[model samples]
Target: MTAETSEPPAFLPGLELSRILYEEGVRPVLDAAHPGLAYAAARVGSGSEVLGFDTARSADHEWGPRLNLFLADADAAALGPAIRELLAERLPKHVRGWPTHFRSDAGNELDPVSGHMTATDGPVDHRVSVDGIGSWLRRQVGSPTAELGPLDWLAVPQQRLLEATAGAVFHDGPGTLTAARARLARYPDEVWRHLLACQWQRISQEEAFVGRCAEVGDDLGSAVVAARLVRDLMRLCLLIDRGYAPYGKWLGTAFARLPVAGRLTPVLRGALAATTYPDRESRLCEAYETVAALQNATGLTEPVDPSCRPYHSRPFRVLHADRFARALAATVTESALRDRPLTGSVDQWVDNTDHLTSSRLEVPE
Candidate 1:
């Protein structure tokens, strides 16, 4: 009989599809032909599922009934084809109401996935596995001999990195899956420290420049600074937990749940909502101080500036300013608590038009 014989239910929640496949499709193959076929796992890696943001519309092709099969090289070579053929023969051609042969509705002419799979429009966009334990480690963190360089912190898009590293590993044999998961669990302490440091440095460099931005008649530029502050601050919280920050859409959701979340939310919301350039600058500076205090409280870094000095100054002032800003962001738990020390200086917030050109950072069209 053709695999298309039975019509299936509507798309199960992405989380449920794996079990549905295992009990029906994958296990049957092992029961019949390859007793040593070894293992199957439903790792919803990459894209929305990994980030826990998947919705109903994500149930298009490349989205559901996905599985990654792992075996000893010999078993894989033997069982892979058998599993495929069996699935082709016995698995329902449609899961839920979705078609197994669904194609791209994406307007562009991108190539569709080349395997037989049903759709749920979920966030899992790919399925894969390493040959064994060693390969899994290398894939997760790079080999010692051919180590992956530390990411170019500034250039990496937060969402892509989140997807690359997100998701759960469903199964493993001989500890290969466990080992890969341990390695993927979190960034090393130093790496998190460095990224947090770099992000804060970026924010501090722009913090007091809001008034200058508005002086050039670009209130929007000032708002961009506020937005970046929010992004970097959210990144800081993720660093505190040793987690990589996901894309911005989920950034706030993640932030609101942090242990220090209660205090941070108001400060962040106030900073984001401040309409006047001066008010925004004050709130931002206060936010920096609050974070600095939290850093000190947490023992994350050495004390630099208890005062939270203005950003406009010479080498020493700039140096201390960046130092405290970095320390606070990495260690602070409650954002509002850290921002208690609001600044009194307004002069540093003003901008000169000469430095406000729109073309210095422009790229070719």
Candidate 2:
């Protein structure tokens, strides 16, 4: 039998579909097949659902009825293939009218099996991935756990780190995978403070250029600098909130959820929408004060003044963000981390997804 529906079906969220597949399909079959197989199941890695941003538009490809079933290395080596084959035969053809098999041809067009839905006969190229946890972690992030040092945390992109920890786990029988996830959830405290300091340093480096560019009669350049500062400020807020900032597509979405977003959004928006340099500078100053207050509230460092001031010797009005940087850096007790330059994490310095996504990313010593 084939898998198809009468008409275009309403959108189903990936997380819900994954849970249903695990409870109704995979769990029963696993119980009957091996009786006591130990495995973990989750819907995670590189999807909007993992990030809680999936929508109807995300249903096209690489979506629907998909999950990761992680087994211990030995269990995976022995029963992986048999379980995969068994699921192809026993699993339901459709979960909430979406196909169990996700078929993509040369042009990447998704074609679900086109006829009747059946339990025993359907396409065999199922979306469920069966693997060992170690292999999965190595595949997802370069390391199996967050035993990462300062440089290791810097090298891995925040997007990758976010993906490594974002989604929901349906079940973890042995709990190894769950434990691994907890370890990978966030950077160590020292690393977080180091990155936070570096982020403020980034703002300090460019905060003066907004007015300097305007002084040179470069309104466009001034606006550009202001926009850059706005992004840095948003990211800094995310860091203060102890949240991972996703890439550009979801950056605003994620930022909106921050505690300070309500007060800061308008100021940031004004900074970006300002055409004149004075207007831009004024709006950015407002943003600076707001974020500085957020920093003070965190009590991460002794509160620095949340007001903008002149960049010394230059006529530019700015926050002199290095003050905040220095305050945060002072709290870092790790000698190695304290001595390192303030480059922050991969996402802070690099905007290109291609470079950030590379597994071989080099961390500066």
Query: TM-score of each candidate?
Result: 0.67, 0.91
Q: Tens-digit lDDT track for model 1 on 1-365?
A: 11334444454665456555555655665667756445635453454556666666555435665555555555556555655555555555444454434334355556444333434333222333324334432333333121233332222333433533555555554455544455555654444455555555665676655656766778888888787776667666666666666544577877776776787778888878988777676676666666666555656687566555544552111123466545644554433323322220111121232222111221111
User: TM-score of the candidate numbered 1?
Assistant: 0.67
Name the candidate that leads on lDDT.
Answer: 2
Best by TM-score: 2
lDDT of 2 by residue, 66-147 (tens): 8889998777888888889998888887787777865545453355532222223554467788998777676666665445
Worst 10 residues of 1 by lDDT: 356-365
